[model samples]
Target: MRIAGAALNQIPFDWAHNIQTISTAIAQAKAEGVELLCLPELCLTGYNCEDLFLSDWLPESALAHLQQIRPLTEGICVVVGLPVRLHQRTYNTAAVLRDGEILGFAAKQFLASDGVHYEPRFFAPWVAGETTTVEHAGESWPLGDLTFEHLGVRFGFEICEDAWRPDNVRPACRLRGKVDLIVNPSASHFAMSKTDQRYNLVLNASRNFTCTYLYANLLGNEAGRIIYDGEILIARNGHLLKRNQLLSFKEVDLEWADVDFSTPLEMAGELVPLPAPDEYRELNQAMSLGLFDYLRKARSRGFVLSLSGGADSSFCAVGVAEMVRLGVAELGEEEFKRRSGAFDEAKTEVVQTGAGGAAHQTAIDVDNAAETQNQKPDTANQALVNHLLTCAYQGTVNSSDDTFNSAKELADSIGARFFDWTIDEQVSGYVGKIEGALGRPLTWQTDDLALQNIQARVRAPGIWLLANVQNCLLITTSNRSEASVGYCTMDGDTAGSISPIAGVDKDFVKKWLRWAQTELGYEGLRYVNDLQPTAELRPLADNQTDERDLMPYVLLNRIERLAFYDRLAPAAVLAQLIAEDPAADAGQLRAYVRRFYQLWSRNQWKRERYAPSFHLDDYNVDPRSWLRFPILSGGFSEELAAL
Candidate 1:
């Protein structure tokens, strides 16, 4: 028997569109001569429907859509996910239909009720050893653990979280009788290091059950809350039969070996079950998928960045270019600006500065400097400032040669239009304006957060101006590590339409940059990657490293997962940290614990205000969606006092 699996892009709360998408897939499967097709979990209604599940009309509409799809399954067996209401309780269920008849159904047993998911609040657990049959359209269909025989192969069905349990489908299917194949229709949310575990589990389960395994997942943004990675894997007898690497809408067929029910034990010998490892392949795939879908779904033309000669901005530029390259091949230079809104008419004029401020002398000095340096003088600071102002903005009164040159080279390499503008005079004017507004001169010290914020805040208007003029989206350059401990300024470094690398830690950002340089051959990225992390707000003497200001990102991420998401107490988390790093000091641990709670709590307000960020892992801090914390609560002072 030939089986096909489709990874579909599902829209949240859009029943008509979802049915149309499913109809297209069914047509494709039929064209491919597929007898049985497995779609993602909750294909009718979106998986991350949140409170929409509680609405009476949602289930009714979803059921109607499912009925509309029933006719399309005339020649093929289709398993689709939908919420089934039974006596006022909802069950996350999958219905198998063929030839306009319901064969059987399976309910999700293992509900993900913690972290970013609260399935238990909406769905009632399907009690084990219980069976029920429902009459739909005058036909009675059996529910719970049951196998359907078609073409001499006994097939069992399960939902997303159901397969995650130890004895979920295996024992039940074994108890019922011999089954040749098990298909899991899932809507698992994206999380770092999850895909590796998922693939391993599927492979191990196939070996343990001695049956063919078909797994299909939902993809794209669901309700703008969670990103689902679409992966379809077909495995048999401890070996992978076929897999699709692209974690979006796609299809795969696996018909390598026939399932023989009589000799099921023969295939079980090849199964090797090992403990799940912490490989982050799924996280990477999820990140890339989020980027791709956000760009496409938002109908965004492209992205633009300031392209500072620093780690954060440079990393963002590289990530944007990489996303564009991967999604669309050889994205040309013109298309970049056209899509990014970077090529609008100049709104500002650029003024070149000579040794003192004469245009003729400045041009002559530029020539002499170029001749002496054996480089194009016009291509240096002054020329860069001119290009930036003309292409990216309207007016620039002064320009810097060195900074502009570096930015130009970086943008050129990434196939983006590069412009340089010197904001020395404008920045000084803004500083004066801010000082006058406050009627005080600012001091330079640790207590000068307001003063520092002004500097960062001033940069936003012009960049935003450029973004708006060009019809392009600005990419925010804050990394996950810094965001954990509140190291970013609201509307400053945090100002952008999307945060591409917010899900990645500082250490991982460096690693990805290095990989881009050595493997991707983007040498301009190497300069930024090699430099030490700094905000570059003050002079070199005020050199501030992010790690010095906040806890180490790796440790912070682990602590966040364990303490916050896993619900481990402070003392227990400390014990785990000490065991992992024996050199951790009492003072450092106490400070991190205190600061983590403070920043985490205080940043809820900021996180809530942030633009929609990609959901790359299970540990996201999107307050409006994934996580919800009271913004006006008393800070972590009371919690720390208890410790």
Candidate 2:
């Protein structure tokens, strides 16, 4: 028998879009002679419906929609995921349909509640050994702990969270002798290098159960904050049969394989090991795809960035470039523009004609012979980027000449419309008003923070007006290290519609910039890569650097991981720091630890108010997604004192 799995990019409750994608997948499967097909978990209603799953009407609506899909499965056995309401509770279930008839539903026995998942809030875990019936449209079917048969092959299910349990307790363990195939429909999220762990799980499950295993996962940024890699796998007896290229740009990606359940295959030397995962390349793909979905789904025209010629902002600019490059590569130029919903026939002409050029704006010139030599000329990718990205260098007197050159060269190299403007007048006006009100001239020695922050705050209004006028998303440049210790001004640098790198750390951002520059062929990054990171909100004579204002970003990131991801107390974090950094002075490590705890405790409000950010790495400091803290705590005074 031939088996298949499809990964779908679905939107929450978009009835026409979701059903159309499912119908397309079913048609393709039937055409390819697939005997059994597995769709992603909750592909009917989408997995990220949040609290709507708790409402009574949602499950009912999902059931009503299921009827629409039944007729499409006339020739093949199809497994679909949706919410099934029974006895005043909702259960995440996989419904089996064979030749236009409703078979049984297999309810998920485990609910995921860790990290970004809160499945327990909206779903009730099914009892392991219990079976029940669900009535819909005046018809009833079995709804729990069930198995089915197709083409003389017995099969059972392990929903997304079910297989994450221990081997002895998972559904596959129980179905070992009873079934010949185990199908898992998942809505698993994408993190850096997380696919390897999942690959091991599926291979081992088949070996332990002596059965063929098929897995499917949801794809793309379904709603917001979470991205699914859209992975599909088919294996038998610990040997891998099939896996798709993840993070696809297509709406539906399907993979299939033929398996013979009659013959018992030897497990020895059957498994083919997947090559080591490259996280740098992985992040590039995930971030590019995430931005593509967010752009089209939010109905925004394009992206507007405050390009300060630093690592974080430069990283974002390249992300948009990569989005256009990779998107147009997979999806043809016409389809990519159509799917974006930003560029129409009229807009495409405007982009190609260079109507949005920065000729009228002040332009900065870079004095590097190598930069001029390495700059790329116009291409299809650059032409699309010219339309999709708009950048501005909002400089003040404190801003540097090197950063201006950095911003302009990168924007030019990527074909992004670049504008160079000064914010010194606005900063001076605000400072004058405050000085007049206080009847004293503000000096750096007396009002250091106030003087520095006014410059950052003043740059927000003009960039916001540009974003508003162009109908673009304003990109915030703060990284997770800045977010961890409140190293940013609230209404200043943190003001944006999206924070792309807030889930990643500053140390990684800097290193990734170099990697992208050298390996990814973005020669414009030479400027930013050569310069040290700084706010430049202080006088040039004072020589302000990020490390001078805060601790080293490496140490800051380590402390953040220990405190939040590891859930360590202040004293424990200090002890771990000592062990990790043995060459560092003990007194200085204690001071850095104390400073980190104090800043973290007082900065919960900032993290709470940040724009929605992607969950890229294994963990993030976003208060709403991965971590939470009190807005007004004791500032960790007692804990720091003990440290």
Candidate 3:
């Protein structure tokens, strides 16, 4: 038997594109003589259709679309997923179609409720070993936990969360010998070191169940933050047969393998060694892939950032570099930007060249004339970055020479268009206007936050103008550490369309920069990595540092992971840290815990207002994903008092 699994890029409620992509996959699979094909879970309406599943119109529209796809599956058996609404509740369901006939629906037995998922709020798990009749298209059809029989072969399903549960209730355990093929439709989001685990699980399940395993996942950034790699895997008897390239740029990616169901193969005695990409490689691919999709999908031409020469902004800058490098390497320069919807912007011809070009504010000479002569005449990767990235150093009266130089050096090294601007006069103008209105002048001693905020906020309008004029998406530079407290100024430093690093902690970004410099050969990052993290909002004489203003970043990240990520209370965090770190004083731990709770509660509004960020881990503070705290709560005051 020949079967196929497709990893399709699906957008929520994008019915026209969804049907077109799905139809194309079906046609290709049929042409390849594939007898059966399996698609990703909830692919019709998309997996990230969070609350849309509750709408009556969504299911009706999905069912109407399903009927349109049925004719295309006449030559091949297709298993497609969609949300089925019946008797006033929704079920994550898959329907089998062949010969222009609807076979039956298999409902998901388990629902994922933890860490960025709220499936239970919208769907109910199918009852085990129960079958029900559902009315559709003026006919009653079976819908429940059941096996399917077609062409004298038996098959069963394992919806996304169903296979991940570590319990005996797994469908494979029940359908072992009864089914010859086990199909898993998933919309699993990407994370570091997760692919290895998935490969092992699929291989082991196929080996243990003595059946062919076909797995497919959703691809690309569908709605906002979550990225699905669109992984397609086929394995039988402990050996992987065919796996498609993940994180595809195309709309639909399909992989197929020929299977012999008449004879069962023996499990190999030796286990195959599966490997994962290194930390840098994984981050390199994931972030680049995420940025590419984010830019194109949002219809944004390019990127704009206030390059502060700090760890946060530098990381954002490097990501744009990686996007161009990776995107160009995979797809040629023209195709790369074409796919990114940045073709018009990045492909524009320069009217002039050198230091003060029309498009490029500044340019870096790699000084690799000999290498360029030896290599390809035109370096495509560097050119792409130079076009797509428009960076500016927005300096204030309190800004230091080191930060200014750091920002300029990194921008030049990456070949980005650089602009140097000072917001000192703007800050003074705002201060003067505000003081005049109040009839009193403000001092740093009396109004420190106001003084600092004006400096940061004054820089926004000019950078925003630069971004708007260039038709680029502005990138915000705020990390999770600063987000834990209200360290960032709203409508100021936090003024961008997307915050790429907001989901990541300060320590990780710093480490990533150093690695990008020494290991990744991004020499530009060394300048920022060598400098201590500073906002540069205070006087140079103060020697202002981010760590001095708050607790150690290492400790703050730990406290955040424990208290916010792990959902631990203030008292529990204090006790646990005191026990775990012998060097920490009990009083210090208590104070840190108190400070964290207070700051976190107060900053919930800031986090809520932050530009939509990528969801990299379970620790994601984007309210759309992992963490959701009330913007106006009791401030955890009672809990802190107990500590």
Q: Model 3, range 302-404, lDDT digits (tens) per residue? A: 8999999999999999999988777776676567757887755223433232221123375423333212545442354666677778888877778888888
| Cα-based TM-score, every candidate | 0.79, 0.95, 0.92
The sequence of per-residue lDDT tens digits that candidate 2 reaches over residues 316-345 is 999999998888889976788889988754
Overlapping backbone residue pairs in candidate 2 total: 0
Candidate 3 — which pairs collide? none
* Sort by lDDT, top down from the best: 2, 3, 1
**Of candidates 3 and 1, the better by TM-score:** 3
Ranked candidates, highest TM-score first: 2, 3, 1
Question: Backbone clash tally for model 3?
Answer: 0
Task: Compare candidates 2 and 3 on TM-score and give the better one.
Answer: 2
Model 1 stretches astray by more than 4 angstroms = 15-17, 86-88, 129-146, 168-178, 222-225, 237-239, 246-265, 270-285, 329-406, 422-434, 445-447, 469-471, 551-562, 565-568, 571-593, 624-643
C-alpha lDDT of residue 390 in model 2: 84
Worst 10 residues of 3 by lDDT: 350-359
For each candidate, C-alpha RMSD in Å? Answer: 7.8, 4.2, 3.7
TM-score of 1: 0.79
